[model samples]
Structure formats: C-alpha cells, structure tokens
Target: MRLLSTIMLALFLVFSMSGAVLAQEAQTNTTDPIIVGNQDAESLQVVQSYFETMDSNLLAEDVSYFDEQSIQAIEGRDMLTQSPTFMYGDSFTEQQLTPLRYIVTEDVVVVEYTFVGRNTGSYATLPATNQLVSVPTVGIYHVEDGQITGIREYMDSDDLYTQLGYPAYTGVQPVAPFTLPEPNAVDDIVDNPPAFYGQEVTIEGGFGEMVGPNAFTLWDEDFIDIGQEGLLVLAASDGAFDFTPVEETMLRVTGTVYEYDRASLEGTVGYALDEGTFTDYQNFTVLVASEIANMDNVDTLANVDQQPESFYGQTVTLEGHIGDTVGDSAFVLFRDQLVGVGGRVLVIAPDFDPATVENNQVQVTGVVQPVDAPTIVTETGLTLDENLLSDYQDWTALIANEVMSVE
Candidate 1:
C-alpha cells in the first residue's frame, strides 16, 4: 500500500509540472508571433502584398497610396495632391521593387528594398530616353493596430542624377585660364583688328569704361580704347552679375571669341546669341573687389517699412553676423542693418552654419520677408521633406526640379 501511494504522488507531481510547462508555452505563443508560429507569417504576407500593390501604383498613374494624411518628406507636402512622385513630365511604364530584407521590431517594421524604374519621358524637362535608374532605398514604417501611421525613406540623389545625365550645378563654372595681356593697354586691341572671334584672346590694360553691373573695358598705357569689340562677356545665368565692385585695375580675359554691334553693346560685350556662340567663353567670371561698394540691391527693415509693398518677392543681397539657430536654420545681419533694437534679418537654411557664413560677407540673393512665428514653431514638430533630406545624402547632384537659368 505504501509503495502504491508513493507512485501515485510522483505521478501527480509529474502531471502538474507538465501542465505548467504547457500553459507557459501557450502564453508565449500568444505574446510573440515568431516564437509560436501563430500569425506572423500571415501578417507578413499581407504586408508584402500591400507593398507589391504600392509598387504597381508607383508604375501606374495611380498614387492613392499617398492619400490624405500621408506626409511626403521629398515633396515637402503632407499629401500626394501637392507632391507627386512621378517625374514632372514623365510616366512610369515598368518598375520593380524587390524587398531585400524586412526587420520587424516591437512596434515598427523596416523594409529594405531596391527600386528600379524605366523612365520613358522627360524628367523635370531633361530627356529620360527610357533609361533605367536603379535606386536603393530603406523605408521605416510604424505599424500600430495593424496599420502604418508614418514612414521615412533614405536614398541618394547622385545615383538618380547620374542615371539621368543631368548637370549637378547651376552656378558659374569656377575654374578657367586667364593670362595678362602684354604692353598693359586696351588701345592696342581696339586699334589692331581682332585675329579671331570666339578665340582665346589675352588683354592687358587698366580697367576703363565701366558699363553695366559687371561690364567694363581696358585701355592701353597710351589710353587707347579697347571696347566690346573682340571681347566676350561672361554673364551669370541667373542674371545676377557678381563683380569686384571696385574700379581701375588691370585684368586679363581668356574666353570664347565673339563680335557684337558696337551700337548694341550694353557694357563690354553683347550677349551671345546661341550656345555655339558662348561655348568658347569661360562659363563664369571673377571680380577682384578690393573694397566694399554700395550694396543698394539689398533691402533693409527700414527700407521695407518705408516701401513695404515693393519688397515682395524681390531678390535682395545682405550681409550680417550670425545669430541664434532656429532648429537647423540660422539668422544673420550686421549690427547697423538690424531693425528695432538688436533685431537681425532672419536667414533660413536647413543645413547652413552661421559660423561658416557669418561675418564672411556672403552675397545672398533671396526674397526678404517677415518670419512667421507660428510656422517656425510648427515646422520643428513636422517631419523633414523627403526630397530635401535626400539632397544631403549626395553633395554632387542637384536637387531634381525644373531649374531655368535666371540669366
């Protein structure tokens, strides 16, 4: 009887331990889908299908995935109504979005993927020629209650531009060759016939005959006049000419050779009529300003108050010291130019450093306006524009947009 009782107790303890183990296993299965193999596979399959549908939409005319409440960082808008992912004038006929990996965390799922699009039309007015531009991107999607509430993407712009064959810069070409003309006189060139038009020519003489903003001529020691004849003027494409802002200095020019009517000359040379005409000239010009000249083009608070309506959308130049940062942006202005008592002009750049540009006297050509206090505060809480964020990833590529030469 005693042996039987001991056997029964041992059996009961074993059964109780087994029951506890089974209950713990069930609890874990309920908590984590991966460990228990319950619903993760089904959930992932649905998510994958959703992504596949999104890829189809990207290729088709439908952009419903970016419906209302969808904030696009690249377009700097909250919805797809204002910012379309498709190129400005192009339509996507085929695309492939291959998921490289999917990392599921506690509350978010990160989808790593490669996107290849066969572009068939002009992208931002640039000919696409049906080229395939493959871009790798990583997207983080916040999943709560089985729905995505937010998304962020990271990618490169240089890869996109290289695939498109667009020039990355809109500024003046900085490097070119120039030699000082011998005999130090502009009169020699005017008196002597130009050997060639659009040919590399060297001129030497004191700066003379100031023309428009950046237009000037040279004169020989004997004061012989060398005008626009045989000279090529390198003008800014944006129509904003930068010069030394000083007078009477000897300089040399090596650029495309061109001829303009003497009567039609606005300054030193007439504008090139075509791409072929301007091809030989240096794309940019350099000014050797030794002193500060009157920068009347820049607007001031006092001036704006006096003529409030005139300052709207007008591109003005300014110089000033750096001030406190508003998020990643900064404000700057000279003490003399500050409005009220110690108020400075606000300069907003997402990734600009006041220390790098402060007191350095940069020539900024942008519109001046009053800061919207509410907007500034609101922007801090909002996510960054995806397109603007992409610009930081690749320094060599220009942001994708319709950029016309301001010249």
Candidate 2:
C-alpha cells in the first residue's frame, strides 16, 4: 500500500490513443476487459482503495495491504504510509484525481491517473508556491497469494515542483503546526485559497509581529520570514484587549480568509489598477479573533513605520495631515505634506454617509493591504507575463476598518 502511491503523478499522455477517448471502456461487462481471475478483480479494488485513502489523508497506521513478508523494494509499508506520495493533500487544497487507464495482468495491476490541484500548502520541508498543476502518474501493484506483495510508482518530479511554484525538496520536512487546523495549517491558505472562503475556522501559528491597532501577521511555523502573502490576521474581538507578539503558538477562532480584487477600479481618482494577471488568485487568510492569548514571553511586537508597501496586510495607524478626496467615499492622507513624493494612503469609507474628512490632521486606523503588486499570467504555455508594481500603479494603504479621533 505504501509503495503504491506515485501513480497519480506518472503517465501524462500528450494525446489519447485516438482523437476520441473511450469512456465506457470497461473490460468486465464487455468481452474485452482487463480482468483475469477473481484475484485480479480484487487487486484492482485494493488499488482503488489505496488512492481513496490517500486523497482523504487517512493513511492507515497498520498497513493491512502489505505484511511483513511483503517485498516492497523501493520502501517499506510504514515508510510508504508516511511517505511524500501520500502527503500531497498536506499542501494542496484540492487534489482531484481521475483514472485514465487500468492495465491489469494476472497478479499485477498498473493504473494511470491525472492529479490536478492548486499548490496552496507546503510539502514536509518545503514552502507552498501557490501555483496550479495538472499531471499524470503511474502506479503499479503486485499481488501474490492474497495480499499485496510489492509496489512501484513513478511521478514526474523533475519539473513538478517548478510547476507547483515550489523549489525542489532538499531532505527537509515542514515544521509541524502548534495546533491542528480546525482542519488545515496557516500556510495551507496560500494555494487554492478560495476553497476555504467563507468558512469559519480556528487556525494557529507564530506571531510574526503586529501590523496595526488590532491587526497582526501570523507566520507559518515552517517559513517564518517568507512575507506578507499568507500570514495577515485581524482581530474581530473587542478592542479592550491588545495582542502581544510571541512564538508560533497562538490560536484564532474567527479567521475569515479572503482575496483582494485588484482591478476593481482603474479610471477612478488616483487609481491605476493592473488589468493583466498571472496567478488566478492572491489570498490572505484573515482572522477576526473571538479570543487570543500569547503563549510566548515576548511582549513587544515589531513596529513598522508608515510604509504601506512594506506593511501590506498589516493593520497600522497613521497620523497625517489630510489632503484630498477621490470619489464620494475615498480620501487621501498626505503624511509627507511637504515633498508629497513619498506617496499617500487612500482612505475609503463608503459606510460613512456624506463623507466629511477635511484637509486637517487626523488619526487613521486600518489594514495596510496591497492593492496592485506583481502578478503572474500566461501569454502562451511556458511564456509568462509578469505584472510588477511599477507596471501599473502602486500605493498600499490602510483600508480603514474604522477611522476615528479626528483632531
């Protein structure tokens, strides 16, 4: 069972044997089927169960498919159960596998399938690339007497990592999470993030630093310093409590994950939206904490200045001399009132009727979320069209969850 996993990443037929694929190509009901004997039919069933267990991430602790006398040449049954072949679900939000071919002989069953999913989570030791991949793999199972005796699997690892947007593994395993996901890890939100959209979950991870009045970055234990792409969290709890930064061991219950729509406004005032895109989605797993506590000894959270680009996804407070307005709801705050080249933070409050913030001094509190950054798109197959910050427009800002205390 352990040795039989790689079949999902193996065979990738450039084209089907014919222009038309045989949908009902079953050998059982028809005169031409792959079944040989009763054992052959059962072996096929066993192989199917193996893939099902893998997809569900419920690898049996005691591998019943292989006994002590099993000749698992490539690896042992226990190793296979915990092996990378079975760990695909750990990093991917969705791994949809569909069988392509099944070549069954007397005692051996070889199967082919295509594995398609977005790489949103990390491998054992590697970080997530947040890319999508679709590839074919081959799996072989050897049945002797009754139980599976041997197994062989092949996955196209040469460019699989590159395709999935991750560096090849170098014998490193991903760091274990402090607390199990109410289903997934913190970094798991990167790829196929929309899968967890609108779902209420409790996630745990390290406290990277504080971003704003009540916003902070929750770092994945494996890649602590990776960046602001995945670890931004906002507290939905009462403002009475202040969150202190600590190690990767805090818990959040109201974590709501969402993605930003970059091209929402282009021709609007001071708005230059990037139209071209690369990745299908760029997500941030946010948490409005119902409850939070620091398990570490550190009491200080790293403070970032009014650097909106640097503080993307962080909740920061800015006291600036107000400047101008864009539309009915959005206004500008010129922190650098003299030079004005340092750029400005756009404050949009549509809920606040009859928008009334003047060019006076005021305190702004909100998340410094990125509006337009670099994005990846495909011109053709391998041809990539990258959208950089300078390519369109750039001005990360404090999206005011609440703007108050005008002075």
Candidate 3:
C-alpha cells in the first residue's frame, strides 16, 4: 500500500537533478537514441529487456542491469530487498506485463504497460482479497550503453488497494468515530437488578426465545443458581439486526435496565408487552436495548468444569441438549447429549416443564454452586426424592434462572 507514495517521494528528492543529467548522458551514448518523442528501436530494446527480466522474475540479473545511481534510487525507496518482479509480484499471482505503449522522449524511454494479476498476497499488512486486477502502470527509464541508468515508475496505489477490498485511502489508517466501554455481564446486573435499574449499561449474555416481534430474552447460562428467569430485552425500535441468532451465539446488549412493568414498558416502547406472554416476568429486570452485537467469546460448561472453583460465584452461559431428567424441575444437561460426549452439568429450574424440551437443545444461565440437596430444597422449595438427592450429593449444580429450547 505504501509502495507508490514512497517511490514517488523518494524519486522526487533523489532524482530531480540526476534525472536531467541521465537524459543528457543517454543522448551521448554511441547509438545516439532519439531526443524527440518518437519510438526508437534501440531504446525500446533496452527498456524491453529490463521488463523481460522482470516478467521472468530474474532478480539478480535485473538488478545487475541497473546502474549504481538507479540502484541507490531504488534502495532509497526501501525496495532493495524486494524481488525484481517488485511489489506487484509479492502482492499478486500469475502476473503478466503487456507493454501497451513506448515513447522515447529526450533519450528517456517512457513505457506504459498493463499489469494483470490475481490479488493472492498481502500488500504491506493489508490482507489478500483473492481478486483479479488489470491496472495500467507507467515507468520512465534512462538507458546508456544498453543499461538502465535511471528509473521512475508510477501507478494509482489507492485504486489498486481499493480494488482489493481496502477502504478508500485517506493517506492514513481509519479510526472509529467513538468507542464503547466494556460491557457489563448480564449475571452481574441480575445479581442485584435494582443496582442497574434506570441506568444505561451494556450487558453480555445468551440469546433467549423471542417473546414478541421485537422483544426477546437474554440470559447468562452460568447464572442458573438464582431464582430470576432472564433479562427481557426490548428491541422494538430498530427492527431486526443483520444476523440470525443461534444457540451458541452470545449477544451484547446496551440499554437502560428497568423494573418489569407492563404499563411503564408500553409507555416507553410505544407497544404493549402483551398481557399473557410477560405475566411471569414481573419483578424481573428488563433491558431496553439501544444497540446489540454478537460477543466474540463466551464461557462454556466445559470451561467451568476445567476450573469449577473459579466459577463458583460467576454467571455462565451454556447451550446444550437436555440429558437425563432428574425430576419435574431438574435435568442433566450435556454439551452433546446424543453422542454422550462433551462436559455435563446439573441444572435445576424451578417451574420448568421437562416435557416441553424433552430432546431439544437448550441454553441455561446460572451461578455455579456446590450440590447440597438440603440447601437447594431450602433455596428453590423443590421436593426432591431421596434417591435423586443422594445421586447428586457433593457434586456441582447450576441453579438456573432461565431454560429455553434452542436450535
């Protein structure tokens, strides 16, 4: 990307005076090449020979063909280490240089050629685009004794870069207009819903079931230990985003948290939360999202199992198929229950109906806690059978806030 600008500037500084002297020297050569703008056979041969070496990728021989002053000029542009095929060879594949025009002016041979190639390599740090390009390039060469004594080349670098998928050049790297602070975890916001109420905050969590045209649930899979179900997201204003949410996709929501209230939400969103659909969400935290994006990384159940102690009080989001059912409100969740592979975790969802998601994929968000049947019964008010209680004793369990069927 920097090649054209660097060479132009360097040549302007180094060859301004040397260029005139080179042309004069070329005019004094034994063949006495033409001083007018007409095609001279010998001058064409010298320039063509140089390009032949380039098209053949003959680096050492091509460098040998250039005189000391021309070599220094090329080195001044930091091109000494490059192949004779030059920047185009490094940034492109299947290169073909077809000389389109040759004009001899005052003993200098001006050659115009079409550089055809596939963009299969990086230009500086820019990535390869795998695109084909055929751009015109111009080069001026001073020949004396059939050797290139001075050289200058020109091409539209911006056009080349943009054709290969780079943004329009502003002579510098582009910067974002604004930056957002790190997002808060949905579990942390849920841990004390009132703390985030009425405040604009960004929260990251799992994408839950869509309850309305523009509203959906966002939950932390690792936050199941609590009694809350999930944070309801009101995304009614913007319509759908440019992506479809899947089971493993984690979403980051930036909005103001509000205490769930139908009348209050209807006033803010300009639409009703619907009577029967959101009845169970009363007293829960609701996020009125202004922006939403996918999170690059999210913690999984296997990540928790690798170091259970580290996530004892942390909220986690995990998606998996429902495993063996322990009771009406509890079931074993496995990353891949069908193959009996991957990590597994115990989930206890109060008011959950196992029949609804018998063999379906589900995402669970909750806090990790040690499996104490007595403590669980005290916290969740679940009447667990003796055999089930004994089976999970001394183990780890996620006290789920939300459990939803997923893809």
Candidate 4:
C-alpha cells in the first residue's frame, strides 16, 4: 500500500508538469488572439478590415470593404485625395500602422493608430523632403451591416509639415500664380480646330518643317506619315521668336487660335505669307503667336551658356560630348556643333566612372551651379587645377546626378 501511494503521487506530479508545459506552448502558438475590450466583435472586425486594406496598400478602387456612398461623400469633402481619408500608400512607402486603442459603440467604432512611413512624394504643393514620419492618428468609422457608412480621420497637419522639413503652417501662405495656360495637343487642335477658335492656348509638338522665315508647320511630336495634318504658326514680330528648325527638337507656341485668314494674319504679324508656300494652310486653323520657345528643358549645352542665370541652381538634363577630364571626378561637357558659342560646361560627378563616357555621347542630369572654386572643393572634395578654377569662375557647372552613355 505504501509503494502504491508513492507511485500515485509521482504520477500526479508528472501530469501537472506536463499540463503546464502544454498550456504555455498553446499560448505561444496562438495566432492573433482577438484583442477584447469595450468593443463589439462585429464592429471590430469591420474596422480591422479597413486597416488591413491600408496595410496592403490597396486603394478604394481596389477594395470592396468601403461603402460606395461613404466613399463618394468623403471624396466630395477632401479635394486633395478625393477620398474619405488620407491614403498613405499614395505618397509614402513602407507604411506600418499600429492600432493603439479601439473605442466601439453599437454603431460607431473609433480606432487610434500610429502611422509610420517614408515620405517620397510631393504633398500639398510641397516638394518631397524624403523624411520619415511617425504620426498618431484617430479614425472614427460608422459601421452598419458589416460595412463602413462614414469615416472621419483626425491628425495634426502642422506636425506632418514639420516632419517633412517644412515650416509650420500658419493661417495662410503665398501661392505662385499659374500664368501659363495648359498645353493642347497639335492633333487635338487640328482635328477639332473650330472648338479652339479664338482661345488663347499653348501647343507643344515637333518643329515639323518650316513654311517660311516666320512660319512653321507644327505636328504631333511623333508624326511621320506624309500628309499628316499640321497647325500653322505665324510667329510674333518680336525677335524673341527664334528656334533651330530641327524636326527632332520640340517647340511650345502660345497664341490665339483662329481660322487661317491669309490677308488678316499677314497684317497682324507684319509679314506676308507666300501664296504658294501657304496654300495648304488657307482657311485652316492657325496660331497667331505671342510667344514661341523650345519645349525641352535645356536639351543642349549651348542653351545653358546663353541663359546661365536662368539655369543656375536649377536641375537640368544636358546632352553633349564629354570633353577633357578636370580631375578624378570632374569633366567638361560640350556639343561639337556649339563649340563656337561656348557650349562647354564643367561637370562634377563623384559616383560616375569616366571610362564609360570616354569618346561617347553622354547625357548628364544634374543641378546647374556657378563655378565657385572654394564652394566646389568644399562640397565635392575635388582638387581642381588652380588656373582652371580661376578661368571658369562664375561660369555654369553641373553637379551630376548621373552620367549615361547615349549610344
């Protein structure tokens, strides 16, 4: 009887120890146990789906959890997103949302979460500062029939701007005037010329063959077929109207669109069109210009020389031949055809390998800055020649973003 009692006690101890180990293992392996609080299960599940959609970077168009009427109503109020709430995935990357608290009633479910992501896109007209933001946000959602009926999100906008390296918002800020008109396609204008009559507009397309000294045929940028419809442009009498007649170059013309009246247009531009030369444009739509300029942003090195101040401190894409190297990280970019006009500009690229661009046509996208030797040396750590530095002072220099061979 003594031996049996001792055996029975040992069995009980073993069983108790085994039961505790099994309980711990089960707890450790449990998957997302429902966080229970003053919350209704049905409403909490609906709210959980809403956040899951955000975590997956799925927009309203891509998901069906949101009510159609709620989305429409929210979009009507939010002009920037055109949605009920801010979509983090639209402007941010690697979004991580942590729900801190959930306050649920019979119909309303409010969730407080922390939002974190890297800002890689422009928002509210502010440039991308590439900063990371971790902001606390609250979203009040109205649920019915396991669907969201309405949503109201609250967050500190000023805090968002501050995190993005911008000044804190006051009541008002200055907005640049939008003076330039939106550009119209040449084909669109040509096909429906009457629709654009008398409207002051801008058209961008190829420098499609020149019709006269002050006149040219403008067609779609890629139009190649013969007899393609073109818009006739009668340039302004102002000397500002000058362009290389290369078909590869694009040009922007801003003027009033009108039915081509040969005699009237001749009187307006102070130049008569040749009868045979402009016969194709008779009674057709034409643009009587106030301005005509290159549409491309600094396509050639020579353009930078002509307007150095305009490009100074601005980023530009320059195409030219890589001239002699200045140092391990610096070289000169110039166009062979533009040598006479001093098309050469100094370029400094720390990450670029010069061998790739040797004797090759290259395109360099970089910021255009004035050649100040002290600043260049300080910023780029390049040891440029003293004589070369003095000679190129106040001239334009490009701190390259990339140097690619254009074969």
lDDT of 4 by residue, 149-186 (tens): 55545555657778988887453222222222367778
Per-residue CA lDDT of model 3 for 1-407, tens digit only, reads 23323444454335323555457646654443323244455666777776777432322333322211121133322353454445454778888887655556444566656788898887657778999988766666655555554555666666776778777555432222222245776767877988878899988777777775777778774322223468888874646445576763578788999988889888887766678887766756889888887654346665565566777877787766565678677887665211111366788887666555423457788888777787788878888775875787755688899776652
- Please give the CA lDDT of all the candidate structures: 0.39, 0.47, 0.63, 0.63
Q: What is the C-alpha RMSD of each candidate to the true structure, in Å?
A: 30.3, 26.0, 26.6, 25.9
For candidate 1, what is the TM-score?
0.30
Per-prediction TM-score, please? 0.30, 0.29, 0.29, 0.33
Give a tens-digit lDDT track for model 2, residues 87-188.
Answer: 363677677776666655555566666678878777545788778888666655665444565554556663577686656534322222122225355766
Count clashing pairs, candidate 2. Answer: 24
- The TM-score ranking, best first, is 4, 1, 3, 2
Candidate with best TM-score: 4
Mark the 10 consecutive residues where model 2 has the least summed lDDT. 375-384
By lDDT, the better pick of 1 and 4 is 4
* Candidate 2 CA-lDDT value: 0.47
lDDT of 3: 0.63
In model 1, the worst 10-residue window by lDDT is 398-407
lDDT of 1: 0.39
Off by over 4 Å in 2: 1-40, 53-76, 84-89, 166-407
Candidates 2 and 4 compared: the better one by TM-score is: 4
